[model samples]
Every structure is written in structure tokens, then in C-alpha cells.
Target: MIKPGSRWKSRVCTAEAVLIRPPKSEGLPQCGGVDMAPVGEEAAPADMQPGLDQGCVVGKRYRSEATGIELLCTKAGQGSLGFAGAALDPVEAKKLPSSD
Candidate 1:
């Protein structure tokens, strides 16, 4: 019987036994065999082109035009609060300058 820590040794022995045996010739359906195109002969363009503006920015602030608040993306923090839960009256928002 194999010990708990000797499990790896048993697995290696089993693998060695399988490797020493001659491979059986059972005809299997082989899909397109090794007739691949030469490297760079018919290679498709990169899935994504580099240097193209893919909506990724290193440092920038994304703000909402409808709100007067601006978000500083350079700092580690949440964006300016939107019109969520505020005790300010509706007349106060109207009194403020238009964000647009």
C-alpha cells in the first residue's frame, strides 16, 4: 500500500508503465493533417489595431453635462455625486447655473 505522501511516486510509476507500452493502431478520423499555411503567408490582420483610440485613456475626467459637478479621474475617489438623495429643494437646482 502507498503512503499518503508517496502518492506522487505511484503516479510517476503508473505513467512510466503507460509510456513503455507500444501505442495501439486504432484508425481514428483525422481532421486536416498538418497542411497549414506558412507563417505570415496568409495571416489575418491583428484582431485589434494598436494606437487606435479604443475608448481607453491613460488620464482623463469623464463628466456629465447635465450636472454642474466635475469628476477628477487622476485622484483615487468616486465621481462627483449625481442628483440622487439630496435634501436641497428643487428651486435650488433651478437657481444654479445651467451645466450645459
Candidate 2:
């Protein structure tokens, strides 16, 4: 139930859905393919702009290509949280006991 003008929320749902989907073509090409560049990158074509915009949740989780690290955009709750960090703060990362 998104409002008509709530394009941002719509985009967030779309992006989350895509991330949850199985790779279409298979192999590395499907999952994070060479052409499937990170959001806000020049390598990402204009056609993908709409999808990326819709997918990206401001002040939320985003894939950082440079460091290969997934960093939080802002404090939790303000933005849609990723699967692991749904309601958690980055400080909680260290609190979780390792399975090792």
C-alpha cells in the first residue's frame, strides 16, 4: 500500500525484490555481473537509472564497490534495513557471537 507520489518507497521494494531473486542467466554474469555495476556509477547505464533509483533506499544499506564493504547509510529505522540489519545498529555487529 504505497501512496501514488511515494516513488521512493516503490523503488525500495523493487530493489529489495531484485536482490532476493535468483540469478537469471547463471554463473557470475547473473549475480553481480560485470555489466551489473554498483548504483550511482558511470558504468551503470541510463536505462538502469530508474530501477536503481527505485531500489536504493536513502540512509539505508548500499553496496560499496570501492571497498567491497556493505556500509550503513545512516542510523537504523530511518531507512529500510537489509536482511541482517533489519533493526540493528552497526555496534551490534561485534556483539553477535561468532559461529567459529
Candidate 3:
């Protein structure tokens, strides 16, 4: 299982992310249609798919509802995040409570 706080980097682009929540099941997170490797590990050069290069925004949280996996993009890049062949959805920011 990929534990929370584990960092990942894209193999095909400069995308970098930190795991916020682990997936309920088993599977690695994919970026640019390729599996992301852990930080510090050398990544083999790969090609980014045409549509999968939508890009990941820095400081945004992406989540996969089906897998219960969530990741925070620490560094923006030319690749989108996904899992199990499905794109991960951006998490909406929670509204702060109103102060009287």
C-alpha cells in the first residue's frame, strides 16, 4: 500500500506530488498515462499520451473517489494525475466558517 505522505514524480514530465490519502484498494497513481515513481528513484524516460498532458496545477489536491486516493500537487507540470485508467478529480477547497 502507498502510505500517506509518500512523494511521487512523473516519469514523462516534471510533475511532482505528495500522497495525502492512500487508496482503499491496490494500484499506483498514473500521470501522463504512465505510472508515477517514488521520489529519489530514477525514472525511465517515457512518452506522455496526447490527452493525458492536460497538466497538473501546483498546490491543488486531486482525488480519485473510486480508489479513495488523494494527492497534492507540489510542483506543476505538463501531465494530469489518474488511477486505474481514470483521471483524478480536483478537490474543492472547503469554505471557511463565517465569523460573527
Arranged by lDDT, best first:
3, 2, 1
Q: How many pairs in model 3 have backbone atoms within 3 A of each other, for residues 3 or more apart or on separate chains, i.e. clashes?
A: 0
Model 3, 15-97: lDDT tens digits are 99999999998888889988999999988978887788888999899998888999999989898898777779999988989
Is candidate 2 or 3 superior in TM-score?
A: 3
lDDT top scorer: 3
Can you tell me which runs of candidate 1 are displaced by over 4 Å?
Answer: 1-58, 75-100
User: Which candidate do you rate higher for TM-score, 1 or 2?
Assistant: 2
* Predictions in order: lDDT: 0.19, 0.26, 0.89
Task: Please give the TM-score that candidate 1 achieves against the real structure.
Answer: 0.18
| Tens-digit per-residue lDDT, 1-100, candidate 2 | 1121111111122232123222222221111111232333334322322212222333443442322323333222122322221221221334567798
Q: TM-score winner among the candidates?
A: 3
Per-residue error for 20 in candidate 3, Å, reads 0.6
lDDT of 1 at 95: 52
Global lDDT for candidate 2?
0.26
lDDT string for model 1 (53-98, tens) is 1221113332333332222222221111111111111111235677
TM-score, every prediction: 0.18, 0.19, 0.91
